[model samples]
Target: MVGGYVRKSKAKGSSNVSYSVTCATCDEVNILSHREVGGLTLPLLHSSHLYRVHDVHRTSITATLLSHMFSQSQGRAVKQQLRFYSSANMSVNLEGNIFVTGTNRGIGLELVKQLAEKTGKEAHIYACCREPEGTSAEALRGLATQYPGKITIIRLDMSDEDSILTAVQAVSEQIQTAGLNLLINNAAINKPDSLAQLSATGKKDMMEVYETNVAGPFLLAKLFHTLLQTAAEGHTSEGDKMSCRRAAIINISTIISSIEKCPETFAQAKMYPYRTSKAALNMLTRCQAEDFKIQNILVTAIHPGWVRTDMGGEQAPLITQDSVHGMLNVISSLSNKDSGMLLDWQGEKIPW
Candidate 1:
């Protein structure tokens, strides 16, 4: 807003008329000379405020140049104004089209509370739960009351393929009219059942945790890629100009997956299967990030700080809100630079 641009165009001979215009976004000025200028209507060259950060700024420069040609015919040339806003200058609305898996309890529950209760944005929360309609926890009921249209309780059992398929179909239908922008894969199980416990995890239970914790979110992202793309397209179509941003995927992971930083001592330390599963999830985060780079989808794992929950128990170090608040801040700070990272609640990069 502090500065604007000026542009000028000129015709060579006595029969030609000259034109001048200025852009406020960038100080760079352009001058054009046309020999035979007539009743040709051209687009007005707007300043490249948003395009400055993109790799393809040339496209914008060309468009601006073409617009300048069109502006000469009209006596009053048009100036497409641009105003720059940074994270420091403007408050970022951290809520929008969101899809959160495993939102019935713990971090997932807290995420819904913060996004809907605190931020109060137009959030479409897909609260994926085993028993979505009737959870034992009354806090969720309170949440539903507080945020009516913002929350949609979807019955998604991560382990059940049939349930996942059904949920996917419903999601596809819901997003056809609108679209999903944010997806949080927060539903995970950390029960302390070891390899030796009950002879190979009953095949049902083995796949159950993996299906929900890992495979379900993986499949969901794959399923919603097109929806995300369309939503991003809509965003660009609106505003002064299009943005390069896309949908985001946040995977709730544990520091126990960190080979070097894993806790040395825990009361229930013999859960080999759970530990291995989370480690695999960490790898999955990296895989998704690497694969979806072009889609502009940032996939990252977060170690929600130790909290007092059903899984963390009463003796945990942090409370639910404290851990979730920090994680939310970290999420709010996410940019293109921080994609494909394994970070903690404090936004510090966690060890692999």
Candidate 2:
């Protein structure tokens, strides 16, 4: 059995709508939002058919469902709104102060670069890395230089607790009481370890990876809880809504973290250290999502896919920009319902 719930909101010069369906056969709820611009409706894919959708464009039912939603939303009162409708590679307008860790290279650098392109002077992006002056972060430095006042490069070693506290203090002093809009825990370490290499050194490597991947994010969230809450509180009118335009914690996870899919993936290469650590990180995402719900701070795990980064290697299929682009769309379209879920770069939920 399936049931539908429709909601809409008007923002600036555009009309946004959300039509969600609850299915007994599928996951609990799937939300598909849309934007109306000059009589044209652009669909924002936020489907709940996790088992059915592995790719965004492949979901045939998405258009049909949006078509029905548009028809149903006519003459509806503006009691609630989804606020934004976006797709992969689409333009997005984000407000408030944004923070991202691991901005030196790979997806982190790409995220900062793309964000700087979208953000204006009114907004600020704090791009954190282990070394702001290091040779590796030269590109990030150049980006910060390009953006000037729009982007601040902060020194943060995610594995070090003192460094996290220092980073938090630095960010807090700059944003004042306005609070942080987004916290992307994009910094992570994937120390190479496998079942075939089980030894003291491998076990040591596991702990180091876990410390950076799981424990670092945990401390960062704990220290920045106040800033996140302040940001969320700013949207009192839309307190019920969860959005990146407000307060959100985006953990840059990987689909390789999926334990259920391990049978197929493990055969390819048993990335024991990286996989297990990310699995723990997913748990952190869920716990934070639950704990921060009343505060209206959204938290979710996102699998950025196999990208051609230093970590992903040259043979990896997807480009960093493409993965970040898709992730931005997914992050922009997140709602209260998405908290605690594990979603891919394409906005489809991944199995635990």
Which regions of candidate 2 are displaced past 4 Å?
1-90, 193-196, 199-201
Instruction: Give the total clashing residue pairs for model 1.
Output: 8
Native-to-model Cα distance after best TM-score fit, residue 324 in candidate 1, in Å: 0.9
Worst lDDT 10-window in candidate 2: 46-55
Off by over 4 Å in 1: 1-92, 135-137, 192-206, 237-246, 263-268
Indicate which candidate wins on TM-score: 2
lDDT of 2 by residue, 197-247 (tens): 444347778889999999999998898899999999999999488888889
- TM-scores of all candidate predictions against the true structure: 0.66, 0.74
lDDT (Cα atoms) of all candidates against the true structure:
0.62, 0.75
Candidate 1 per-residue lDDT, tens place, 191-217, comes to: 444324545455666566676678887
